[model samples]
Target: MHPAAQQAISTLLAEGKTPSVATVKAKLTEPLPMPVIIAALASYKNNPEAITHTAQQSQPAPAKPQSQLDRIEAKLDKLLALLEEKQ
Candidate 1:
């Protein structure tokens, strides 16, 4: 199972062993339905590249599309100007 592979990877990492993708693939003796074992091993292998909660950024969000809002504002401005001209 994935848990077993995870344990193996964790142990290997703890023992300062840098296992390759093939090495991790060889560790899974039992037949599994998916590649969760591979994924778990990749997580260990690429931990530095993997995103984590500690790596979260604290910055403002990027700008989003505001065309609808701009159009509505233009319409409102036109209405206001029309009302002023009528009065």
Candidate 2:
């Protein structure tokens, strides 16, 4: 994420929401042109040293896209399948 975006995420997390990265990605995408978004992302990449995991400790909006939840769901499905296979 860009510093701006990272800053945005940290602001959200600070509010007590455990959002996903995708959510932050999506927030930046909203109503903004791609080039602007691209620039912001570039800005973020250029200063990665400044954007460590600490930003996640407190963010504005939830991270995003619910990828973690989805992954968990998929994992559970696989486990369920394995259990059925044993039966």
Candidate 3:
């Protein structure tokens, strides 16, 4: 199913509204095929929590910051390069 369709279903559930093909289709920002909408709705009806879990898993993980030791090492490397150039 399309991500938008999944999101539409999730949104409808959150708003305490039942998700039918028409409702999900209407909620969608972009146009999708009737079959896709129907499939999504059926899947959602069968396993509501799966939809929410899938949506959460679909999100990209946050980037990790460089460690302080890594930063210090980089600075030391640069300083050594500068000294080598001077010599």
Q: Number of clashes in every candidate structure?
A: 0, 22, 0
Query: Rank by lDDT, descending?
Result: 3, 2, 1
Model 3: per-residue lDDT, tens digit, 1-87?
788798788778889999998899888856799999989988888898898898788864655655557778999999999999999
Each candidate: RMSD: 18.0, 11.8, 12.8
Candidate 2 lDDT at 55 equals 65
Candidate 2's C-alpha runs over 4 A off are: 1-29, 53-58, 61-87
Candidate 1, lDDT over the whole model: 0.55
lDDT of 2 by residue, 15-75 (tens): 6654344545565423445555565556555764444464655445756644556878999
Which candidate ranks first by TM-score, i.e. highest?
3
Candidate 3's C-alpha runs over 4 A off are: 59-87
Best candidate according to lDDT = 3
**For residues 23-73, could you state the per-residue lDDT of candidate 1 as single tens digits?**
555554443444676666567557733322222342225555345568689
Q: What is the Cα-based lDDT of residue 74 in candidate 3?
A: 100
